[model samples]
Target: MIRVVLPAHLRVLAQVDGEVRLDVEEPTIGAVLDALEARCPVLRGTIRDRRTGRRRAFVRFYACAEDLSHEPADTALPGPVAAGAEPFLVIGAMAGG
Candidate 1:
């Protein structure tokens, strides 16, 4: 099971509490997001673009202390995250002037 940690807003949108555990055959960001969206259909357009399927500008992915926001969606995550030892963090990036 892969553990996913969502930002407060997303958790509220998804109506979930605490970490979300999912089974992913391939531990890639794309696969993980696919699973997440499948499990929580309400999150379809919140994390990624509904048309382009790209990561939203204000959404960031992190795990094992690495910034994965700019990484390709197909890129595989670290072993600790894949093994459920660490949480895959989905943070809502802050932006301001």
Candidate 2:
């Protein structure tokens, strides 16, 4: 299972609490997101584009304690996440004026 941690707002929107676990055949960030969306349809458009299927502007991905800001679509996630040993945190990026 791929553990997922949702931001407070997203959790509230999806009416889910704590970490969510998903099963993914392929160990990629894209696949994980797909599973997340499939499991929680209410969070579909909140994290990624509904049409383009791209990650949202304020959404960020992290793994292996590194920032995957410019990673390609096919980039493989960390071993822990890929092996379903660790969670791919889905945190909401915060901004301020």
Instruction: Say which candidate scores most in TM-score.
Output: 1
Residue by residue across 1-97, what tens digits does model 2's lDDT show?
A: 7888888999999889898889888877888888988999999999889998888889888876776755766778888887767778876788999
* Model 2: ten consecutive residues of lowest lDDT: 64-73
RMSD of each: 0.6, 1.3
Q: TM-score of every model?
A: 0.98, 0.90
For each candidate, the alpha-carbon lDDT, in order, equals 0.96, 0.83
RMSD of 1: 0.6
Deviation in Å, model 2, residue 61 alpha carbon:
1.0
Backbone clashes in candidate 1 total: 0
In the predicted model 2, the residue pairs found to clash are: none
Candidate 1 on 19-43: residue-level lDDT in tens?
9999999999999999999999999
